[model samples]
Target: MTKIADFRAMTPDQLSDELLKLKKEQFNLRFQAATGQLEKTHRVGEVRKDIARLQTLLRTKQPAA
Candidate 1:
């Protein structure tokens, strides 16, 4: 559950790192689902949205840099 303001406060490098971390979590969540080991199913959607947010923010920031 990340806020847009929190993402906006981060530097581009920090945002990239956060995006990578979210992607890893997304992978793990997918694996868990495949194995039927996932409990909090809603987290997958959350991570996906967070990753998208980071990507969008990065793109918006890039044009200004």
Candidate 2:
């Protein structure tokens, strides 16, 4: 998992790709939880937080037209 500061340095396209990857991971985590296969439930929260952090960084880095 990448840090928020490192995420902030990424370009918008890169950030979007990262967000997509994180979302996919989150979905898998949810599935694992439903199947009782999740060994690390805390990872779900971490992925959610990372998603939010990436979004915030994307918004903050957007240039004013």
Candidate 3:
């Protein structure tokens, strides 16, 4: 789990990598939920939030047009 401050400290590339990982996790979690094999159902929401956080931070770090 990464805090907002932690995301702030990461480089754009690192943030993107983390985002990709989270998305993959989110996909797997969704599959597990569909198959009734998910133990921590709450984890799906957490991963979603983390994905959003990383995307927000990455967008903020980008140069304006």
Q: What's the lDDT for all of these models?
A: 0.98, 0.91, 0.92
TM-score of each: 0.96, 0.89, 0.95
Q: Which candidate model has the greater TM-score, 1 or 2?
A: 1
Per-residue lDDT of 1-65 in model 3, one digit per residue for the tens? 67788889899999999999999999999999999999998899899999989988888999997
Write the residue-wise lDDT of candidate 2 on 1-65 in tens digits.
56767987789999999999999999999999999999998899999999999988888878976
Residue 62, candidate 3: Cα error in Å is 0.4
Task: Report RMSD for candidate 2.
Answer: 1.3
Query: Cα RMSD (Å) per model?
Result: 1.3, 1.3, 0.7
TM-score attained by model 1: 0.96
Q: Can you tell me which runs of candidate 1 are displaced by over 4 Å?
A: none
- Across 1-65, the per-residue lDDT of candidate 1 in tens digits comes to 89999999999999999999999999999999999999999999999999999999999999664
